[model samples]
Target: MFRFFIIAAEIIILIIVLRSSFVQYLFEDIQNSVSDWLVSVATLPEREELRSLKDKINIRLSPLKPYQQNYVEQITADSASVKRFYHTYCENDDINPNFTGTKRAQLCLIIKQSPVMQVAKRD
Candidate 1:
């Protein structure tokens, strides 16, 4: 009975570890996909034109509230900061740079979501 319990405990532990690892992998894959989508959208030529149209529509439909305005400003500031940081550190670097891939993806996500930008358009 003692030996059986020991084996069962070990198997359960192993299963838990494997499940944790799989969950982590899934989360990472989702993040990467979202980051890639955001990067593509941001770089698109039509983005600016669309944004302008959106602004016009919003103006006609409903004015943004103070909270929404603040959110939009924050997002814009965050995006600018991210771009500046990337250009200064990652893009212009001559050395290995040694930045992790995960961090880069995170920065990309921040640029894409732009909480401030979303707030401006909120319903």
Candidate 2:
């Protein structure tokens, strides 16, 4: 019984002393290292966004040339783009029924992440 008490008291005192010593920092370091070793914190990789071509047409009266309109149409034919743009200006079928080709190209330029912008940048 006396030996058990002595051991328990020694353990309590040792813990109290260690809490006051630099060993506490060492223990924290070991804990952090073990935590790092046991599990990696997941994170997404960094990325740069591609800059899209300007929407500003030099022409004052003319619409997009057929090739450019075709390019925009080809790029936007993608399901992802339709899903994206449907929520955007394409949803404005109410507005576009009367507006012309220039207005549609302008909408393509508006969505920065669209593949149309990226493909135009490539071309």
Candidate 3:
């Protein structure tokens, strides 16, 4: 009889604790932490060669502004986009006034010289 009362009291206390804001917040925090950990574990790590290539490119591009760096990255990602954009805009320079022909050519040259692009060509 005494053990039953003790178990019932514990259960009641547990219910009250669960309803508290601190407990709810703690549960949410733990859940988010576990979710993040699982994602990191499931995601494959970056290859060392690619990482090195990216690092080298980053160093070379350190002098460039953020938007210019984006241009270089885009050129490496899809060289065809430049050609399409050129053909689409070259007819009317006012249509796309952002990246001029000379600037695009410079970015292409930098991308061509990057180790990342060279490695990509091998495969």
Q: Highest TM-score among the candidates is held by which one?
A: 3
Give a tens-digit lDDT track for model 2, residues 83-120.
45545546544344433476665554454455444544
Evaluate residue 107 in candidate 3 and report its C-alpha lDDT on the 0 to 100 scale.
39
TM-score of model 3 vs. true structure: 0.44
Q: Count the backbone clashes (under 3 Å) in each candidate.
A: 3, 0, 0
| Residue pairs with backbone atoms closer than 3 Å in model 3 (clashes) | none
Stretches of model 3 off by over 4 angstroms after superposition: 44-53, 56-68, 72-123
User: What are the lDDT figures for the candidates, one per model?
Assistant: 0.52, 0.51, 0.57
Task: Tell me the TM-score of model 2.
Answer: 0.28
Question: Candidate 1, overall lDDT?
Answer: 0.52
Q: What is the C-alpha RMSD of each candidate to the true structure, in Å?
A: 17.2, 12.6, 7.5
Candidate 1 per-residue C-alpha lDDT over 3-110 given as tens digits, one digit per residue, 9 for 90 to 100 = 999999999998898689788899799999999999988766435633553354335424555654444344333434434544554566423233335544443344
In what order do the candidates fall by lDDT, top score first?
3, 1, 2
lDDT of 3 by residue, 1-123 (tens): 999999999999999999999999999999999999987665423234334534555575456668756654553344344344434544334443445566545434554564544545676
Pairs that clash in candidate 1: 71-116, 72-116, 75-116
TM-score to true structure, per model: 0.24, 0.28, 0.44
Model 1 residue 74 lDDT score = 41
